[model samples]
Target: MRNGKATIHDIAEKLKVTASTVSRALNDNPRISDATKKRVLKAAKDLNYQPNNIAAALRSGRSKLIGVVVPTANRNFFSSVIRGIEEFANSLNYKVVISQSYDDFEKEKQTIEALLNVQVDGIIASLGKTTKNVDHFKKIISKGIPLVLFDRVTNDLDVSQVVIDDYYGAFQATEHLITEGCRRILHFTSAQNINIYKDRKRGYEDALLKHGIGVDPELILFSDMQLEDGRRIMQETLDRKIEFDAVFSSSDYSVMGAMQVLKENGLNIPQDVKLVGFGNEPFTSFTEPTLTTVDQKSIPMGQITAETFFEILNQKDQGSIIPKKTILKPELIIRNSSINKEN
Candidate 1:
């Protein structure tokens, strides 16, 4: 009875019927008569019959499991994405398992290996900040398993991927500051070799060039984009007397850090210094002066990421090379931080 749990055989024995008939009745096969099906169900209830999902999976050749990997799970953006994936996947009777790499390259590789070992139907992931090699991801492709990437993607793999238009978001932010009468804007970016940061930097530069304000190398600050990094960089910039009237950061955390430092130094936001940040985190709205930032469409990205994974799994030819690439639009959320009341 499978370690005290009632099985199909117990139900069949109770009803004096064959195990096959009980299985068919439980599955609601049309071939079984309604009267017999009703009898089988009654016996199953009385015996507390439980079906073995492992056996069913083996017979059907499907685990009905999906794995999701992210750099950090605590962030609002990644959590929203996970919600979207779970909502859609649950609707299809699939379960999800999530893992975090903490932006560590080795941890990422280990996470992928563990997911693959579990024989999950597919995997959806965002690249880790320190990930520069694609060999671990290639192992999944070699095994003919579907692997879909979202947000932080690498160009080395020909796999289905989803990302926001970072360039456009950055351009919009930079241009908004310019319209607010900010010419010498300081840009806070990450030093890691990630595509999103690179695209944002390019957008920032292009917007400055378009407005006849040349890019200043000294004004571009690079770090991990953490809160402490922002605080330290702003203080250093102030100490060095680098002239800047506005701040455009690629991350909300760093920009928020910059805001605290600015306030502590007796600088007034939108009065003496304008500000804009990427990724409209929840805290942005509750600040003293609301922050202007970009929304990355986290929920939609998660939903589309799940849809893309299923698409790959259901493909007629699993060996196809034409992978899908989806680019979502980013919205600029303007607020009190970047608006110049004087202008």
Candidate 2:
């Protein structure tokens, strides 16, 4: 046995078998008897043998490595989605490499390039807030690598995508606020360049118009939707004396900032001013007066995104498969933040 990393040859030598037989046994080929397979596995374990994935990849032209890009990794929504993706991918003997864009378009592009350089078999990504142009992503398809976009995606790219119905989720959130007797609803969101935010803004506007309320442009505020942005927007609205009975924020972090300002001003929640947020973050349920929000089905989105990638991989030889769009339904979790007492 060599002093270096144990190879299949070492296991074969220990078991008095050929390297080809050891390899077949390791892969659980049907021709290998169960007893032989067990003996080979025990020998491999005893030698601390580790498969050289790089060598195997070179032989098969598949790395079995998946690259994942998210706008940010700190958020619960994205984290949960990643967990789901890893869960499914790991079961299939695939590994995942994760990268965060921090919502920067340049960073997102760089991440894709880096992943490509590593020759990952596939990529799953969520667009950054500033990712209006998808040319960088198109390049991935040009290279014949499978790409799947989740949560944030664009129709410009002919790629498989998994996302929740952002428009309907926003509409439900806004309609719920309106039903709770909030006429002047303020919207706090991120850049409209992102399709998810754009859909949410449209939903908010349409919901108001449906209820015979004229759309107020001033009520809509766009920012990075960070906690500080939320605080600033809320404080600015209060300072300007903007008439608003409720707020529907596109992010939970921003909503928490708004809630802090409301508390500071001694405004009674759900009484003086109701509030709702998108993305059912963990903190939302634990906050005082538990926030009402939309559940984007993040985990399922990731699972389906990974599943879709495998589907494409399986059908790769059947000529190019048509791109598909998978839209999941969002659910509203009503809590003290926006529950109507009279209902």
Candidate 3:
């Protein structure tokens, strides 16, 4: 036994029986006599013989493991979600294996294949920006393995999805800017393929519409939610000679990049160009302007995802359960970015 892990051979030797006999006893084969079955089970318990899960999975077509696919571990939001998932999974005696897609569809495909090869009972996933073909996901579903999509889920799939109200959060933030007397507000968004981005963009649009302000397509720009992407976009805005009074970015890192560019231009934050960002990163408050942003309930989201997956897994023995889709509300955190002291 390695690291206190037991092998079937240990139990069979202890009971003076063949390894096959011990296996049959564990599986409750009718061929094994009751007395021998009891003796084998006692021996297994005494020696703490735990069957190899890999072999068991091959026989029963399932390993009590849950697979999770995320973009990356760099962000606090994703890390918190993983923590929540792990905690919930541990409490339920289930193991979790996580994979990083790095926003690459090919990496995602390979990760999913690896999880499936291990015979995971279920999968929890957040789609990458480059994920356009969902045929691989469909194939996983066809294998009778339940799938749960979260965060950046595909709009085309008819599957259960979990995420926050991005549109409302963005709308609220934009509206706050309008209330604060920002006549020219720029919106920095990410990929349009994902539902979260689409929702946030819709919110930005709706806020402008509600305020009776004319929508300027030129004021909106899309980036990859990276520091460099944010820096490039802000530089381009400056090159266009656009004098915007405020900027609302979809990501905190992007907001930071914009701030860096603005600071280098000798432009005072709030006094010159007010800013707001999404995803309440821990470092937001420490920024010079202190970013105003949206607080996505990440820990709860992760916990709920785990709970929902296990709820489905528990019901699998009975039959299919009614599909569940849960959407949580995001709260806006007002900071120096959107709120000028003079106002």
The RMSD (Cα, Å) of candidate 2 is 2.6
Off by over 4 Å in 3: 1-7, 10-51, 317-320
lDDT at residue 86 of model 2 (Cα atoms): 99
Native-referenced Cα lDDT, model 3: 0.87
> Comparing candidate 1 with candidate 3, which one achieves the higher TM-score?
1
TM-score of each: 0.88, 0.89, 0.87
Worst 10 residues of 1 by lDDT: 50-59
Error (Å) of candidate 1 at residue 68 is 1.0
Range of the 10 consecutive residues with the lowest summed lDDT in candidate 3: 315-324
Clashing pairs for predicted structure model 3, backbone only: none
Best by TM-score: 2
TM-score between candidate 2 and the true structure:
0.89
Q: How many clashes show up in model 1?
A: 0
Runs of candidate 1 with Cα error greater than 4 angstroms are: 1-56
